[model samples]
Target: MTKTEKTKQFIIEKSSVHFNKIGYLGTSLRDITNLTGLTKGSIYGNFENKEEVAKAAYKYNAKRIGNKIISALNQSPSGAINKLMAIVDFYKNNWSVIIETGGCPLLNAATESDDAFPKLNIEVRKSFIGFTKIFEDIIKNGIEERIFKHDLNIKEYASTMVMLIEGGVLLSKTMADKEYLNISLKRIENLIHNEMKL
Candidate 1:
């Protein structure tokens, strides 16, 4: 890549964890410079301002977590049901890692930016909806393939799963109990097995 592109990427990589760990209001341009070991001029040259950098950092963090989920999903060979289980398993195993930087990116952004930053809030909502749709698609496929019960409600199940997961993450972070996160995940698994008879 070009020098400018490389520098921008470097800034994103370095600042992602910091921004995630600290909300946009909490993080500052100085924090980005300190984390990246770049001058304000360099950072500003790469990004228009703190808001621009925050957006990029958030996207970087989301992409990393997304890849992890996708990788776990790919490991299951038993089709959509197993893939769905794998998705849950991934969350169970990596709860700490997923929340280490910023609890849930969508949850963080939604709660923090919703009223303050309309544009970013919209992006966060879209991301959450997109993720729910992934689960919905999986459920639909499973039903079509007879892996999941035909009576299953894909939209409802997907929404419930996402809400539970996000709520669990938030509660766990607030209570400082990783076990709560696992319990929440187990509940989801039980719900899925009981509903789908998997």
Candidate 2:
């Protein structure tokens, strides 16, 4: 990468966790400068504004989370059902990293940006849609493989699972009880298993 590109990535990587932890409104330019040890001119040279950097940092955080999920899913040996369960397992194992960093990026952006920031809101929406599509694709594959029932509505089921998982993350963070998240995930597993048997 070019010098400017490398600097932009450096800023994004350094500030991503802080942005995710404290959020866009709560984070300041000084915070970014301090974290990256980059001068104001340098930082601004790479990013047009604080908002741009915040958006990029949020995307970086989301990409990291997505990568972890994809890695776990790819590593699972069983079929789609086991792959789905592996996703739940990943979240449970990474709960501390997730909760400590802030919350699920989707939930954080949805609650923080949906009403105020149009650009960030759109980004969050697209992330949600993309995540749901992953589940949808998995369900469709399972159905084609004769694992999931033929009558199942892949889109609806996938959407419901995504909503429940995101909601469960929020609840777990709010309640400070990981069990809430586990229970929600168990319900999803049961739903999938029952549908598969039909």
Candidate 3:
């Protein structure tokens, strides 16, 4: 990459976790400068403003988690059921990282964007819709394979899974107990096995 591109990426990488942890309004130019060790002028030279940097950082954070899920889904067995299981296993195994890194980026962004950060609201909503659509696609494929029930509501089921998972993340993080997430995930597994499967 060119020097300008590399510098922009560097700023995004350094400030992403801080944005995820402290949030958009909470994260300041000083924080970015500190994280990136770049002077305000240098940082601004690479981006139009803090909002631009934040948008890029949010994308980076989302992609970080998205890539992991994609990898897990790709590595799973050919069966559609196994793909769903792979998603469950991912959250079960990776909750620590998600927690440590300031919870799920999609959840964090969505929560913070609801009342504030108008610029980010659209991006956050699009990301979540995209995520829910992933589950929908899996269910659609499962139905085609005759592995999942054909009568299921694909959109509702996918949306519920996202809600349940995010709710679990919030509860687990707030309560300092993984059991909350465990319960939620267990419910999802039950739904898949009992409700979704044929």
Pairs of residues clashing in candidate 1 = none
What are the models' TM-scores? 0.94, 0.96, 0.98
lDDT of 2 by residue, 1-198 (tens): 998899999999999888887887678999999999999999899889998999998899889999999999989986778888888889879998899888898888888897777888888998999899889888888887888899888888988899888988999999999988898888898888776545
Candidate 3 structure lDDT: 0.92
86-177 in candidate 3: lDDT tens per residue?
Answer: 99999999999999999998888888878788878888888898889889999999999999998999999999988989999999999999
Error of 3 at 149 (Å): 1.4
Ranking of all predicted structures according to TM-score, beginning with the best and ending with the worst: 3, 2, 1
How many backbone clashes are present in model 1?
0
Predicted candidate 3, C-alpha RMSD:
0.8
- Poorly placed runs, candidate 2 (over 4 Å): none
Compare candidates 1 and 2 on TM-score and give the better one: 2
Instruction: Give the residue spans of candidate 3 off by over 4 A.
Output: none
Candidates sorted by lDDT, best first: 3, 2, 1
